[model samples]
Target: MSKRNRASVSLPKGVHRVISRGREYFYYQIGRGTDHEGDRIKLPNDPRSPEFWQAVRQAQGLIGQVPADTIGALIDAYETAWPGLPRKLTEGTREQYRRSLKVVRTAWGDLQASSLKPSHVQALIEKLGANTPGSANNVLDALRAMCRWACGPRELLDRDPTQGVVHFDRGEGHRPWTPEQLSYADEHLTGMLRRAYVLARYTGQRASDIIRLGWTDVDDGGFGLRQKKTGVRPWCPIFPELDTEMSKWERRPGPFLLQDNGRPFTTNQLWKVFNAAREETPLDGAVWHGLRANAAIRLRQANHSIAAICDMLGMSPPIVER
Candidate 1:
């Protein structure tokens, strides 16, 4: 909390200390020239202290912060170091990882990371999946991934506790969007709502890939991308249905799906907007991923083989069948 302690601390981006009087006052500032210009929030002086980060989170109005130890502390370290990791994670994938990690931290924050065992993970699966197997599988996958990351490169764990664990039977998984529901979405949805649906339904790309797509990805033949989740690169030619809609729209220099500031939407930001629009229509049970399933269905209906669908969508055959 004093100037001396902060002398050795490196401030995060957008944060700075001003020497007002004999004390160093820290503040997080944003939008130097934009409309939100001059926005600043005071922070604790000691950047080495957890209290400093707690104040940072409070300033950003972020949730799911715990200042304590064991599993919770490990999760915090992972969260902080993830962005700087060698692999570039898509915003949507980050959101997905965060969701699962939150579940683990909520239940076992007090447990030591090294104390985790397969039995504990299995028990957690049952407790989480007693009602929603799908959710439990997601949590299990997240925990396993975190443990794997912690084991490698970071060396935060001695071993993976989720090593022996497997996913619960999430029967049928996500319900693929029916033709009628998609039809409803196509007719009712407009602008980015329509663009988002069309991209997912036509390309069979996940929300992560969709958000990363820009006009630059498109060429004379199709749009190309290396999938965020699977790392498979697929060149998706424009479909007739999709071509008709996108052709009518004004082409942008960056991503087709843009926020007001001409920047691509983050996964959570797009979901809130996309779902908010979906609620106004009768497209019941419509999720962004559901449209990817619908894309496979369309491909299959056109006599494209399962192998082709798998290759195109960057999905495994088992998942394609599902």
Candidate 2:
């Protein structure tokens, strides 16, 4: 039982320290003149091991750095990251950015602004593509915008990783509902949602704008409201047919056509109820938003002037062409 036991050891020096193990350990420094802290750390076995602790040591260099030390800084870094951009966008566009932030936070929200790398951007765009093809390009656009905001106005990064990303389908811009489809949808739907759909077809307002519509906007068989998306104003005399429908709803509180729990509807929440309502209707391929596009296409088909369409739809002329 008295067999001798021995251990092999070797040490290296240079900005390094020694550590000991067992019941006790001793401190030693290669340079006596230096007043650095004691180096009696417990020696890790297999210094060449794949699990070596050197990685932790390497990270120690970044201990005292700030967000300015990396390119991954927060949204506040830019005085106007997308200042006028956000305002120019409609409430719907702002909501999209809010959603985009969720994905960014999940990816690298904690990293400093200066440390964001092209690789990180590429990875994020790839993931966006995988998760939501239709929205993937949009996410890429948002991320690129954030990076531009973070990178300063001088175009800091060598190449924007998201620059060339293509949409999942090039032709998915708009899919308008035909009159036959609208008729079928209306016949299938009843109550407020049907009327809402009718309004969407005529007004061409985005669901975001449509939900906020109220009785106050209507007057003498016509309605007037400021379009949120384009900041344009359009006043349309309600068609005689629609006028009859509005006359019946004089008892509701406030001005909005759609309501949630008796309050005005929000864009995010209305879709669920809209979808549920659609299931009962004969409408297929008719998304809540499709109503807006359908209305636009119909307006165009009716030879409504481009400017009139833009004002009524709250979109720019360029958007209408797109």
Candidate 3:
């Protein structure tokens, strides 16, 4: 392939030109010293053409006319400011927000934040609730936080659209696995699946944390780490059951659990394997997370106080109480 000639053509203060694949494309920057400073509006036309100039002026006019306090803009600003905030978002939480943001964008991305009515939010929630109430509730919660941030010292919005939007009741989530179900899983699950199950049951940690556990995490008759979801560092004594399970387990190169190819299990991989194991058992509605609940219940049965249980599970007292 011949080397393509590239040239920089000076345009307006906020506009520039670049050549890629022998085609010139123009980009207009929003401005300097703003959340979207580096963001550029791409104009897919010949930069020297009259149509291109017309398009640039039209885009500039639209940018000037549209308020910067749209729902999409506020979401961007909130994300840009999130890292500097006192309350930090966990990785899992950030991922959840990213997913929820897609839903929010689909509904009210371009709507002016201050002009959004409670009824609009309520309608979106109702529509989402019809199919996936839990997901709808999650989106509602995320939107509420974003709106609250907008309404804070920034005063991006005069009112919050999520102010009175009711979240659909999802009810108590995944239940604890019964002793018999636990025994069934113990007997039936093998290899990485069995190790993951035992680890989750013993540590009362989420699947994401449990799958990431390694030999380094085990020390001084216990294993501990700062949880990814909550950022709480929990050190729990290794139970006899977990010890026995680990004793018989073959050590893997990476994480405690490995896929057939010996790579550490991704979240989706672990879920698929766990679901396969669940399919073998007679237990219905028993998820991998249910083991965490089962572990908490076992601690409760052993007469551990709520506070102690909270510490063991790395959960807040309110959550454990719930």
**lDDT against the true structure, each candidate:** 0.76, 0.57, 0.75
Measure candidate 3: CA RMSD. Answer: 9.8
Ranking according to TM-score, highest score first:
3, 1, 2
In terms of TM-score, the best-performing candidate is 3
lDDT of 2 by residue, 175-223 (tens): 7786777778657767667667777777777776677677777756656
Using lDDT as the yardstick, the better of models 1 and 2 is 1
Cand. 3 Cα-lDDT? 0.75
How many clashing pairs does model 1 include? Answer: 0
Residue pairs clashing in model 1 are none
CA RMSD, predictions in order? 7.6, 17.1, 9.8
Arranged by lDDT, best first: 1, 3, 2
The TM-score obtained by model 3 is: 0.76
Question: Which digits, one per residue and each the tens of the lDDT, describe model 1 over residues 1-322?
Answer: 3455446455666777889778778898876557876678888765544456667766666666545336766766566555555586665567777988899989888687778889999999988889888889888877776778788655678898987778786576566887688778767787787788888888889897898887788877577888877677877778888888778778768788988777789888898887777675667567888878788788888998888788778888898877
Report the backbone clash tally of model 3: 0
| C-alpha TM-scores of all predictions | 0.68, 0.64, 0.76
Q: What's the distance in Å from true for residue 172, model 3?
A: 2.5
